[model samples]
Target: MRFGHTFGRWVLDSLLPPRCMLCGEMVDEPGRLCAACWQGLDFIAEPLCPCCGTPFAMPVPAGMLCAACLAKPPRYRRARAALVYGRGGRDLVLRFKRADRTDMAAGLAALMRQAAGPLLHEADLILPVPLHPRRLWRRRFNQSALLAQALGRQAAKPVLLDGLERLRPTPSLGGLNRGERRRALAGAIRVAPGRRALLVGRAVLLVDDVFTTGATAHACIRALLGAGAASVDVLTLTRVVRPDIV
Candidate 1:
């Protein structure tokens, strides 16, 4: 069996020589970034806000909350992201989400799994922030759902794709301020009918592609809690980190 597996890998590699996922440069293995691309990614580490996982510029005491988080805490108990949404990360996410690069889901999900850490272990159920049926039809797939499915498999957790529903389509949140984002997503999400039972007394891990102002996460958390979920945490592939938060 071992010999056959090794031979199979050799055949596959010979046919499709291992290359970087970001750049086409040949690498030791497939589904990996080249050293240059890997170095360009800003993976979030410790010394961040405990509530929102916003990385701080300077060293601070552990468990300290950022001013924004302290002033107005997010609905979710905690949030974590794998990468800072900057040049390299942003391009990668955009390609995965907008360019029909579903093949990138596994690689992105691996990063999320590392970032999720204890959140996955503690979550009783995993779910994605839903897209409205109209948008889903247009896109032919929910990017978040793809990430959630991949992460669920890695974590050995049950994924509930239909656990939440988007009640209505909202305008683009791209240019909206924090308050405006909150208003735009208000009442836009809810637990699916007859699906609340799955959430009752469970801790949920909400998955998404990116965390901007967190308007979407807030809405999803409200719906999950209203459905009797004991608690909810958020995990995303990337997030916008503020520079002034030092």
Candidate 2:
């Protein structure tokens, strides 16, 4: 069986050689970045706020919170992401999110799994931030759902697909401040009625492709909490380093 599988893979590779996801350079596997692209990624690490995962300019004692979190704490218990949303990270995420590169989910989710060890381990269920039906129809898929599904598989947890619903469409959040974004998203998302009982007392790990501001995560988390979720944590593929951009 192993030999047959190996031979089949060899044939497949010969016919359709793998290429890097970013630069299209020949590579050993699909959904992989070339060395240059890999090195360009600023994968987020320590010296960050324990609450929001925003990196500190320099090392600080453990348990310190960023100013934003300390002043106006977010609704979620915590948030973590794999990459800083710089030029390289933005390109990769746009391809996966807007260029119909669904195949990249697993690879990206592997990174999220590594970065979000504590969040995944503590989550009782995984839920993706939902897209409105109109947007979902236009895009043909929810990028966040794809990431959540991939994460669920990697973490060996149940993924609650469609457990959350976007109640209304909102305008572009770009250039909005946190307060503006929050107001725009108020009452825009909710936990599906049928999932309320299931959510009760369960620790939810909310998944998203990117974290710009806390608006989207906050909306989903507030809904989940209102529906009786014990708590919600956020895991994202990337996030804006300057979350104030939105």
The residue-by-residue lDDT of candidate 1 on 1-246, one tens digit each, is 646865776687669977776777888866578899999899998777888898888888877889888888778989999999997889888888887666678888998888887899999999999999999988878999999999989889999999999999989999999899999999999999999999999999999999999999999999999999999999999999887464
What is the lDDT, from 0 to 100, of the residue 238 in candidate 2?
Answer: 95
Q: How far in Å is the alpha carbon of 184 misplaced in model 1?
A: 1.1
For residues 1-103, could you state the per-residue lDDT of candidate 2 as single tens digits?
6468657766775589787888889888776788989998999988878989998888888898888888888889999999999877898899987877677
Give the poorly placed runs of model 1, Cα more than 4 Å off: 1-15, 244-246
Error of 1 at 4 (Å): 28
* Model 1 residue 4 lDDT score: 80
**How far does residue 186 in candidate 1 sit from its true spot (Å)?**
1.2
Tell me which residue pairs clash in candidate 2: none
Q: Which residue pairs in model 1 clash with each other? A: none
Return the TM-score for candidate 1, rounded to 2 decimals: 0.91
